[model samples]
Target: MPFAVLPAQICDVEPVYDVYFAAFKNEPIIEFLFPGGGDRKAHTAGTVQWWNHDRNGYTVKCVDTDTGKIVGMASWDIFWRPGEEGAWPKPDGAVWLEGEQRTKAEGVLVPLWEMHEKLFGKNRHVYLPTMAVDPDCQRRGAGRLLMQWGIDIAEKLGLAIYLESTEAGLPLYSRMGFERLTYVHMIHKAEVAGTEEDVEVPLMVKMPSKAKGMAFEDWAKRGYP
Candidate 1:
């Protein structure tokens, strides 16, 4: 099954959301963030909208070339310098959340964002906020294809790439040269069946390769291929 990676368009939202929801639905941190999970899909949809509408990030999709179905997706945002022209839009609120859901969501996200900024704010880097593949499409190279899109761009721009990795994603990221910088933990307020008492996310970073000006063609020939 061959796939092609390209910049995602507005029309790609639903499929991209589907992949993200399916991939993270059972993730511990997602369970912590969404609590009971009734509004998880809606929350994810809103996020997809934010990513697409913000106009300050890159959203890439990996589509099955034969059928044109999106098998994987990845989104990256460059945190701009102070007073930069195109800063990412701040969310007005988690409109998709309500009552307790809203409280829980913010409870978990606020500190996480603060920690992220404190740790990585000084560097001009790319942030990989979301990446997912269809559940059935795991281990088919879709992840690598999607990840390579960011790797290539980061290398070209001489910037490091940062991501918060779930346990399942740690191995693949390690293989790609990302090193764990720190761990972020969030406690669950309400006990849920099959959910961990706490969610631990690893902050990882992959610095640009020292061989900085390497052309894509040469980089591919050397190792990426």
Candidate 2:
């Protein structure tokens, strides 16, 4: 079946949250964000709210045309204001982290912010904060279709695209023209003897495509700004 990519509406929040939660339930960053396994659902919901409310980003959903179901989604924003300072803002009502998890998150994010500024440095660009496909919808082309929405816009604007890629997502992003810039490791504190581990997340960027001179009207007709 074919997939149609469209901008998400406010009513799409619940479904998008479901996909995001299920997709990342076992991801290391999710584990770090909501340690102790308590209030996981609430924390995830809070994240969705933050993305929708605080970030004011453009969200695109990939709908399976035959069934009209949203199988994948990606949220992106332009962070181009001059003189913006500090690390990326934490999600509103974010879950609390303690000990190693807090240290690890801070350690990873602080440097990630520095690298982002060093590389892009106030150039107008698209920043992808989240993207995920439904667990049941894996291996379909929905993810690629959703990503193409951002790629199209970035290509038209001649702006770079940036995202932090999880280990599971690196291959897909690489195929989409993103190159790894650096890696951020999040170490899990050992709850049981000899069980500590870490996850490597790569920071990736895709430079704008050479194809340019497309008008806004042309992009809008294709369902993008």
Candidate 3:
């Protein structure tokens, strides 16, 4: 079915949540986020509050025309402003290995603020966060559609899109023109019965607007910037 990329307005919050949960079904952080175990109602309420707080966040939902269902979703926002903390709540009470992970993850945001200054040099930028596609729709081109839409919007506005992603999603971003900025360790402390273990997350980056002449997917296959 043909996919349509539409601006995700306030009304689209619930649908966007569906895509988010579906995409992060296996992610441990998500499990921590919804400790009650995938309560759709709680998730919906949280999303509504988040959207209300950050009205500037832009979302694009990929809807399957035939089913008229939102199969994928991606969100971006203006770069980190001084003293402004972006959303994405910290994982709740850690389970053994997760306690320590939270501390490290919390610290990463500070460096992001520093990096924002270094990369854009005091000028505002755009940051991409929480991108996801339905489990059944994996590898079906929906992610690419949303990514291209993000690139188009960012370029038209003459802004740079920044994001930190997992190792699994690296190829997708690279294909869409994101470059690997660093492979820094993401430290997260999780506690299980008062014990600690650090969870390491790899970080990367890309400048889609700057890669206009290149084919991101091809470049991604070759591990090019």
Candidate 4:
């Protein structure tokens, strides 16, 4: 089926996260975050709250052109200058899941932040928090369509694109020219499971100013790199 990419609207938060939830529901993190499977209402509320005050965020969706149905979604936070991302205002996370369901989020989130800072520090870059294609739509190029949105921004702004990749996402990201830096192991001790659980996600980056097409631009040298 054919697909097209476009910016997502506020009304899209629900469906967008629907695809995301379905794509990641089986992941250990979700199970660890919500304990029992979470309903769409809670997931959508959290998604909305996350984007509410995030001024630097960019979100996009992929639609099945033939059927006009959404197939994938992606959200990224753009850091245009040094220290800007850190200083930016944020939404009150307390508005999301309440009680322990919310507090438990600190486990994966804190470590993820530590790893993020460790990787880029105060440098400007694009941070991909999450992206997902519906399970039925896998291997159909929807992922590439969604990713290219940020790639275009990163290339135009000359910033690096930083994202964590699952094992299944490796080949797609690798083919898109992202270099695998290292594995970031996020461990969350599950009080319910009574054991330590960890997810080994690959850290990847695509640095700008290295576009193959740039070789042919007016400012480029006579020959390609």
Candidate 5:
């Protein structure tokens, strides 16, 4: 059956966060963000609230056509037009992070701001900040499906796609026509329990073009974008 990719509704936030959290559970960045098995339910609620407001991003989920389950998800910051970006204000109850966790988030976002400006200053593009498939759902082309959704939109808008790729994601990104740019050290020594090393990820880009990632199955033969 053909894979199904759809706009993640607010109602799907819980499962979306479930896949995201589970996938990133062991990632160092996840440890820094929510030390010691943080509140997953609250994070899910916050995601719903935030989506109710206007944001320059999109979250999509890949469904298991056979079982009707959300097996993977991806969140993208779309900068399709020029001269976007201003204040960081959100609704009063829109924030999820707080206290130490909030600070850790800033530690990561702050450097990302600088890196983005330095690299693509004012350039229109799509940024895939986070994406994940359920551990049990790996190797099923869900990742590729979620990525193709972004690629399709980015190509249609004539925008380049950029992302900070984890070590495991490098090969897949490369297969998706993304070129490795440079390594970005967002933070060093997370200072969280059980994590005390520098945090760095590779910067990668896939300019809008005809090529698409044919990594899993026969997406190329299937005529995917």
Candidate 6:
């Protein structure tokens, strides 16, 4: 049976976080990183709160026709140029705003925007921060289905998508119509890098709607490398 892509509700937090962690567990070896751990319940609650924020968006997966048991997830946002209504603007390469740049870009001003705009510029880009599938469900096309849902939504909304990836996800994103926008090199604190966490991320971008005519399936196969 096909995994269903659905709007993730606040009640589905636990399972969604489970999938998020499982899908990225190999992140340590794949990219030498992991999100902060422990108190998964609290983390889930926080994530639910974060994703529900007005500036962000998300989609999740569950077994078709069943009570919500989130098996996969993809979260995104609509990029607002710095000077537009509800826009957060910074002078080019401004570092003073660095302390606020969160992954969700809530208070993120410094590091996040500089890094974000450096690649996407001041356009309406679709921001996909996390995409993961449960470990028990790997190799079963769950990730692909979730990703296609993201692509479909992006196309419908007429926005280009942007993301950063660990080593394991590079091929998958490439196949989903994303291209290498730039590479970010990081030197984590030795303690952090030495731990079984800390990931190296490579930023990527999906070709804009106007770029080409490749069918989704064909594009998925060709660039999935």
Best by TM-score: 5
Per-residue CA lDDT of model 2 for 36-85, tens digit only, reads 55465666566567666654378888888999898888988865444444
TM-score of 6: 0.68
Model 1, C-alpha of 103: deviation from truth (Å): 0.9
Which of 2 and 4 is ahead in lDDT?
4
Candidate models: Cα lDDT each: 0.71, 0.67, 0.64, 0.73, 0.72, 0.59
Q: What lDDT does model 6 reach?
A: 0.59
Cα misplacement distance, residue 80 of candidate 4 (Å): 1.3
115-197: candidate 4 lDDT, tens digit per residue: 77766655667888888999999999999988898999988887778887777889999899887763445444565323465
Task: Put down candidate 6 lDDT per residue, 66-93, tens digits, no spaces.
Answer: 5445677877665533435433334343
Off by over 4 Å in 2: 36-56, 80-108, 182-195, 210-225
lDDT of 1 by residue, 107-151 (tens): 656665766565554445678989999999999999988898888
Per-residue lDDT of 85 in model 3: 49
Candidate 3: C-alpha RMSD to true structure equals 7.3
Per-residue lDDT of 69 in model 4: 86
1-225 in candidate 5: lDDT tens per residue? 446889998889988888888898888767656667678776776677778875677999999888878999999888765454632222232135777677776666556667766556555567888989989888878899899999989889866687888888887888888877633344444453235666566778786654454321232233323
Judge candidate 2 against the unseen true structure and give its global Cα lDDT, from 0 to 1.
0.67
* Candidate 1 lDDT: 0.71
Question: Quick one: best lDDT, which candidate?
Answer: 4
Sort the candidates on TM-score, descending order: 5, 4, 1, 2, 3, 6
Cα lDDT of model 4 overall?
A: 0.73
Clashes of each: 0, 0, 20, 0, 0, 13
